[model samples]
Target: MLFLQNKKFSFSILFLLLLLTFQPLSSSQQLKKNVEFNTSKKDHCQKQISASLLFDITLHGFLLWASMGFLMPVGILVIRMSNREQCGRRLKFYFYIHTILQILSVLLVTAGAVMSIKKFNNAFNNNHQRIGIGLYGMIWLQALIGIVRPKRGSRTRSLWFFIHWMLGTAVSLLGVFNVYSGLFAYHEKTSRRIRIWTIIFTVEISLISFFYLFQDKLEYIQKQGVILGSDLVTSTDQGLSPNDKQKELPTDPC
Candidate 1:
């Protein structure tokens, strides 16, 4: 009987040890399950973040290039051809294309400016945004000025032409600056390509305008015995003519 009692006591102790060991293992398995659940949730969140980034890039990238290439140039062309006298009567078809392209360009640019603000308001700031806003306002005002279509003979119309010309030139210069800033900021392969082409075109146009027009004027003044060089080029004020109050030729738009 005493031997039987010892066996029962040993069996009870063994059973208790087994129960304690199994309880801890069960709790560890539950903790592992919780960790796995949290890991899956984190992965899902990361995927969502990636998807949002992709969407913004796809939409904004398309509009950015489209406005730069198509709209700004069209705006300039529209202003240049606003007068039928400038373009002969038979070239009206070309003017029509010019008008249509200008309208489309303005619409696209307006839309793009708004979308850019929506997406990148925080990212783009300083002179870049100010220039863009100024360009947008100037282009819209230019379009309005275009509708009046000034007649060269009328003094009032001539004054209006001066105003339109100044505004148009301002907008064009600001647009070019804005494009330069954008390309610099991005510096992607596409932006670099545009930067190279822009620099080449700007240099070509500048050289042509300086030599063909300004040089001829300078030579004519030189023949009249007026020495000319960088000083005349840097002059801020337009000095009065020999007849100080005489009206310049109506042919000069500015």
Candidate 2:
């Protein structure tokens, strides 16, 4: 009977030890699983948040670029071409079109600004944001300047024109640069492919530059032709005899 009791006690001790040894392993496994699940949940949440941010950023970025980068330059080009046309009616038509396009651009930019403010809660924190704010302010100021333009013959007209031209050119160039920066930011934030956008933007800028250069050369040629024609006419008149010159002169209607 003593031997049986001792054997039973030994078996009990072994059983307790086995339980003790396995209990910690089971708990540790459960804890590890819990931690992994929590980590996965966190990763999913982060992905969702980043996706939302990317959507808003891309939408507003496109709008901002369209308004300031694309439409503004096109408006300026239209007005420039109108000036070259030198026809009052055509000029007036294009002037109205330019104004309408610019107003549309301002509206688009305003919408984009609102979207950006809603998303970021602060402006001018980053380089892109700072440039965007400056561009917005300058655009509105340019519009005001257009509205308060001096009369064609006013003494201050030249000064106003100079200021307007310089300001407009600066705004356009800055806007282009800002768009590029915005694209980079978009790429960084979302890790989406930007090669296509970069290519498209490069093509657009190249076309615009080519058109500007061609137009400039064409204008220069036209001016030179006009000057040469006037010189030839003057020389021909000088070569004519006095009687021929008098005969060529317009007679007073009696």
Candidate 3:
């Protein structure tokens, strides 16, 4: 069931991308004429602000949140797979999805960032441009890490892994803040659906992240013959099981 759901989501995102890409292109001529008509010396700055506002509110806000919603869980899965003691069909599936999702996420972010930068390069003191470059670099570095994560048991690999996690987390949190600021900048003036959907997507991604944080703990408790019900909780004073004792796990993802 989870597999099916993920497949459906992947298709939906692809469809959405296609629609958004083509629809805008189809109307570009009309949009260009409209912009020219609205162009005047007195209103030049206003036009830039309006363009920036539209890109930030529409593309950076909702689309960014939604992309994170779909990508973060897959990313967590990729890391989990790298740490797993045994590989199986599920791990392979996760690898495939993770790679594909990472690429798609980069593409989506690139499109949005390009639109924002082109629309408001000078008006915003290049804040948007800087973010665009930073985000691009982070995403590419993450992709490179994913490609090499299987061999990351080495010292260099471990170093890259740490860097990857730090930068990835920074980018994700920055994206969240950027979206929030965009929303606040247009509060009560933007579409109600955009606000509501962004909130819903954020909450959903956060919950998934929380669950990912407990993956190791859950595995340890299960290996110790404890059921994964509400009854299980970690105790600092208690000794870990032999299975868990051999494994030095890091802190939770959350």
lDDT of 3 at 217: 79
List candidate 3 segments past 4 Å from native: 1-57, 125-133, 145-155, 188-195, 224-254
Q: Whole-model Cα lDDT per candidate?
A: 0.64, 0.88, 0.66
Which stretches of model 1 miss by more than 4 angstroms?
1-65, 68-70, 74-88, 188-254
Instruction: Assess the local accuracy of residue 91 in candidate 2 as a C-alpha lDDT between 0 and 100.
Output: 81
Using TM-score, rank the candidates from best to worst.
Answer: 2, 3, 1
Better of 1 and 2 by lDDT: 2
Per-residue lDDT for 91-149 in model 3, tens only? 67776776777778877776766765665444544444455466667777777776767
Residue lDDT tens for model 1, 1-254:
99999999999999999999999999999999999989999999988875775566445544544554445554455434443345566467666776676677677777767776776544435666677777778778887887787665887887897897788667656665666665555455233355665676467446544543554465467756554555574462356564553554345556
As for candidate 2, its clashing pairs are none
Task: Name the regions of candidate 2 deviating beyond 4 angstroms.
Answer: 1-45, 121-125, 223-254
Tell me each candidate's TM-score: 0.55, 0.70, 0.56
Question: Comparing candidate 1 with candidate 2, which one achieves the higher TM-score?
Answer: 2
Top model number, TM-score: 2
CA shift of 135, model 1, Å: 2.2
